[model samples]
Structures are given as structure tokens and as C-alpha cells.
Target: MTFEASLAETLRTFQALSSLRPAIDRAGDLVLATLARGGKLLICGNGGSAAEAQHFSTELVGRYQKNRRALPAIALNSDGSLLSCIGNDYGYDDVFARQIAGLARPGDLVVVLTSSGNSANILAALAEAKKLGLDTIAFLGRGGGKAKGLATCELIMPSESGAACQEAHLFLIHHLCERIDAAYAT
Candidate 1:
């Protein structure tokens, strides 16, 4: 696709996100509630989605737009050594799940992002989060694939285009960060 075509697709996807407001609000509320109770967020993804996970963590732990108190958030895929260790020792699919098992507490929220909701590691992480009795938010695409209905709240992108889906996820991430900044603004 040409750059213009891609841009048009992205705009269309973003426009459709208005339909997800209630679900997006629920996702934001879960984040706020967890942080309000001194709980952290455990975020994970793969490839570009993994980068967005770290972006989400940094926005929370550092700052989005406000000079507010720092909130706790971990990008489970940010630690290369830990991910490699788990992948080599357990399996690639166990990387995020192992971290959730080892690090998550009762009040923490698990956030997983996936352009295609069929990755085994993401599935494992969601299952682990559920097993631990923790609430979760899943940012998904491609009709939510296998990971649909697996999360406490899901913002399934309204587009089937992979790039458009990811862009939509980032938009929601920024929107959620705005909500966080509002809640924690100094």
C-alpha cells in the first residue's frame, strides 16, 4: 500500500474507535483503580506491539503530559535477559506468563497488546493473569482472534489492517495515558 493509502486506513481505523468508548473507559478505569490501590501494571506484547507495551509503561512510570506522581508499570518484554532466560528455559510461549507468575500481585493489572490476537505467548500471559485472579486489559485486532473474551476488558481495534490496528492501539494507549495523567496530575 502507498503511504497515502496507509494513512487513510489509519484515519478510518481511528475514527471507528469512537465505538469502543465504553470498553476503553473500562480499561482506563481498571488502570486507575489498580494504581489507586497501590498496584502496578504488567504489560506485554511482541514485536511492534512489544514496543508499544514499553511505551505504555514509560508513559505511566515517567510522564505522559503532566508533572504528576510516578506510577508503577512494568513492560514484561522490556527486560531482554529475563525474556531470553524464560524463552530458553521454559519456552518462548512462557516468557510473559513466567514473569506474571513471579511478579504479579493481587491488585496489579495485566495489559497485553497484539495486532494479531493469536500469539501463544500472549495467550499464555492472559491465562496466567486469569489464573492469578488479576484483572486484565487486552488490546487486540483481527477480530480479536483466539484471545477474544479472555480479558477483563478488551479494546479490539475496529480495523482488520495490521498497521491500522496497531496505530489504533497506540491511539488508545495515548488516550489512556491522558486519563492517567488526569488522575495523577500534580
Candidate 2:
């Protein structure tokens, strides 16, 4: 695609995201509240979404456009040893779910990113989060697939392209980080 075409696609995706303001705000509020209650965030995803998950966790645990105390956030995809073990023992689909069972607390927030919103691991993790009484949020695309109904708050990117969905997910991640920093900065 040409640069101009890419830019146009991005703009259209952003425009579609504008309608999800309420869901985005709710996600930010959930994150802030979880932190206020001394609860950590658990994040998981696949491929590019996995990278985005780690990026989000790093922003919270380090700093996000500001100097501040670290927040408790973990990217479940960060642990290669644990993931390999879980995948080996419980099947590949149980990686995130297994980790969630072991690490998540009641008040913590579980965030899963998936362009297809139909990854078995993500869906399993969301189900596990619910079983463990953790609130779940999904940054999803492709009409949210089956994972939409599972998330407490679903930010379904209004795009059919995986690239567009992933791009929008990163935008939402940055927005959430900004909101969290602003909330604590006060």
C-alpha cells in the first residue's frame, strides 16, 4: 500500500475507535481502580499483540511519559520458561489460563489483546479470569469473535484488518497509560 493509503486506513480506524470512548474510559477507570486497591495487572497476547502486552506492562511498571513510582503490572508472555512449561504440560492453549490461575488476584485486572479476538489461549485466559474473580478486558478486533461476551469491558476495534486492529490496540494502550499517569500525578 502507498503511504497515503496507509495513512487513510489509519485515519478511518481512528474514526471508528471514536465511538468506543465509553468502553475505553471504562478500561482506564478499571486499571486505575485496580492500582488504587493495590492490585496488579496481568496481560497476555500473541505475536504482535504479545509485544504490545509487554509494552503496556513496561509502561506501567517503569514510567509512561512521566517520572513516577512503578506500578504493578506483569506481562504473562514475558516468562519463557513458565510458558514453555505450561504449554508442555497443559497444552498450548492453556498457557495464559494456567498463568492466570497461578498469579492473578481477585481485584487484579486481566487484559488480553487479540486481533482476531478468537485465540483459544486468550479465550481460555478470560474464562479463567472470570473463574478467579478477576475483571477482564479485551482489546479485540474482527468483530470480537467469541471473546466479546467474555470480557467485562471489550474494546472491539472497528476494523476488519488485523493490522488496523493491532494499530488501534496500541493506540488504546497508550491512551490508558496516559490516563493512569494523569490519575496518579494528581
Candidate 3:
């Protein structure tokens, strides 16, 4: 495809995700509620999605805007030592779940991201989150795979391509960061 075609395709996918603004707003509200209730936010994913999980958590736990107080957001995928030990002891699929069980409190927010939306680790984590009374959300593409059915809130990308879906995910997280920052502003 030409550059113009690629650009148009990218724009098309973004336009599709734009339709999910209300749902994203709802997710922000959920996260804000969790924070207000003194519950931490936990996030996880695989590969690029894993990176996005960390990126989003960093925004929350650090500063998204200038001179903001830190919040509590943990990315389960960030600690290689914990992941390795758990995966070695149990199985790879249970790595995230085990962490969630240990760290997540009731009314916490757990955000799971998966490009295919069917990652076993992510699914297991979501199940654990639900069991622990977390407010769950998913960033997924291609019909949201199994995660859609499992999540309390889902942001499904309009496109089927991985790149497009991932782009949508990034934008969604950015919006969340901005909203969270504004919500906490005194």
C-alpha cells in the first residue's frame, strides 16, 4: 500500500476507536473511583501490550502532567524476578494471577491488554481479578477475543490489524492518563 493508503487506514482505525469514547470515559470513572476508594491499580499484558501496561502504570504512579503527586499503579509484567520465579514454580499462565491474588485489594482496578485478546496469562489474571473483586477493563482488538466476555469494561479497537489495534490502545491509555490527572487536580 502507498503511504497515503497506510495513513488513511490508520486514521480509519482511530475513527473507529473514537466511537468508544463513552466506554473509555466509563473506564476512567472506574479507575478514578478505585483511586478515591484507596485501592491500587494493577495492569498486565504480553509483549507490546506488556509495555503498554507498564507505560500506563507509570503514568499513574508517576506524573502524567507537570508537578502532580504520585498515585499507586503497578504493572505485573514489570518485575522479571517475580515473573520468573512464579512461572518456574507454577506455570507461565499463572504468573500474573498469582501476583494479582497477592497484591490486589477489593475495589481495585485491573487493566489487561492483549492484541489477540486471548492470551492465557491475561485471562488467568482477569479471572483472578474478578474473584478478588477488582473493577476490570480490557484493551483489546479483533472482537476482544475471550477478554471481551471476561472484562467488566472493554475497549475494542475498530480494526483487525495488530498495529492499528495497538495504536488504539496507546491512545486510549493516553486519554486515561489525562483524565486521571485532571480528576486528581485540586
Q: What Cα-based lDDT does every candidate model obtain? A: 0.95, 0.93, 0.88
User: Candidate 2 — worst ten consecutive residues by lDDT sum?
Assistant: 177-186
Reference-based TM-score of each model: 0.98, 0.96, 0.95
**Superposed Cα deviation of residue 99, candidate 3 (Å):** 0.4
* 2 or 3, greater by TM-score: 2
RMSD of 2: 1.1
Q: For residues 5-122, write the lDDT of model 3, one tens digit per residue.
A: 7788779999877689898888888898888889888999999999999999988887887557788999999999999999999999999999999998777889999989999999
Candidate order (TM-score): 1, 2, 3
Model 2 alpha-carbon miss at residue 13, Å: 0.4
lDDT of 3: 0.88
Candidate with more favorable, higher TM-score: 1 or 3: 1
lDDT of 1 by residue, 1-186 (tens): 999998998999988899999999999899999999999999999999999999999998899998998899999999999989999999999999999999999999999999899999999999999999999999999899999999999999988898899889998999999988888898
Clashing pairs in 3: none
- Model 3 earns a TM-score of 0.95
lDDT of candidate 2 at residue 181, scale 0 to 100: 81
Q: What clash count does candidate 3 reach?
A: 0
